[model samples]
Target: MSDIYLFYKPFHVLSQFTDERTDEESPRTTLAEYLKVPNIYPAGRLDYDSEGLLLLTDDGELQARITHPEYKLPKTYWVQVEGDITDEALTQLSTGVELKDGRTRPAKARRMDPPKVAERSTPVKPRKGKGTSWLELTIMEGRNRQVRRMTAHVGFPTLRLIRYAIGSWTLEGLKPGRWRQTTVHMPEQTQKVTLKPRKKGRGEHAGSKTTHKAHPKTAQPKSAHRTPRKPKGGR
Candidate 1:
């Protein structure tokens, strides 16, 4: 069986399990501090300064689905910006924001009341004189520092950023530095259930074909290079 972990990552912690920084005067915080799991890898990197839901898993295919740009999984963030954001800025974000890389795709953007997320382990120190407002912005593309750049392009610099959700998963009930493991259906498995019906079996309803063709072995990257298997039953 494969396992997926939803971690509520906190501010000031590196998204990586190991800090590759060789010049650090002090030990920096990393996922290893809170998560002791072995072998599982984070599907995507959240900025060290950004806080919120991060998905890690032991399944490579699952990881690819969650992280690859082709899937277009929607990621939403609760962003606190330096200005009391205006509708004009929201409209620009909803339409498209031109970045150095290129123009970002249209997004779902709107003002939000202050969110009830846990305070950062190190408190956010906003600029002394500027006012701030919150925005709930959803984007499908994961360009580097995209949200920060988009808000800044429109003259409202991001002060504090919290990723609130990815796809259908949310940070609900998870607090900073905490995590929970759960089963996620592979896309094919989900499709199988919706595509057809089959012969009934004992303890199952009539015309039921819901069971997946279980491999029993742990899930692996479908396209990863591995030694060719000998013929089944070894001739």
Candidate 2:
């Protein structure tokens, strides 16, 4: 059995527990500052500049299930972007955007009203001569800064990114820098099934045999483009 937690990560807080960049004399705000739980780790990362709900767990299997791309769990983000986004841009975002890595899957994108949340310590720098708009974008895949890249591809660079929900979990009542213990109901264990190769012709070499091995679900390593979720900044 494993314990789960939902944390509302605040701006400028590192998603991880340690700060390799600084020693004890110059310690920065990390997960250790807000969460006192031992042995729990973040499932997926939210960049240092972003903020919102982050899932933490002590179970490796549960973590893999949530972070692996095969599950296709949707992550919804509330993004504040530069410029008055046009319908065409929104459509492009919903359809798919061409990123440097590859084309993203079609997403659920729509204009949104300003969200009511805790204010950031520092305000977003006003665009030189551009207006801003809010958008609610939902993506099923967790790529490196996917939302920010997608918006930028559609000509609306993101100014603030907040992940509001991941799969069924949400930041409903959690406040910035606050956390709570929780549980995840996982499926019951089932026997593994492996398919063996069918019998070959009678004359065929009896010594030759084949078997199909099922690949176990696993979590991927961090990616090159994936930014570190460290204590450094805001929304």
Steric overlap count per candidate:
0, 3
Candidate 2 weakest lDDT stretch, 10 residues: 205-214
Q: What is the lDDT of residue 46 in candidate 2?
A: 87
Best by lDDT: 1
**Which model scores highest in TM-score?**
1
Query: What are the per-residue Cα lDDT tens digits for candidate 1 across 1-235?
Result: 3456778888878887777777678877888888887777787878878999888777666676667777677899999999799999999999998899999999999999999988777776678898889999999998888999999999999989999988766677677888766655434332321213221222222232222322322132245432222111100
Total colliding residue pairs, candidate 2: 3
**Residues 103-152 of candidate 2: C-alpha lDDT, one tens digit per residue:** 99999999999899898866777579987899999999877788998998
Candidate 1: misplaced stretches above 4 Å? 187-189, 192-235
Residue 99 of candidate 1: its Cα lDDT?
Answer: 93
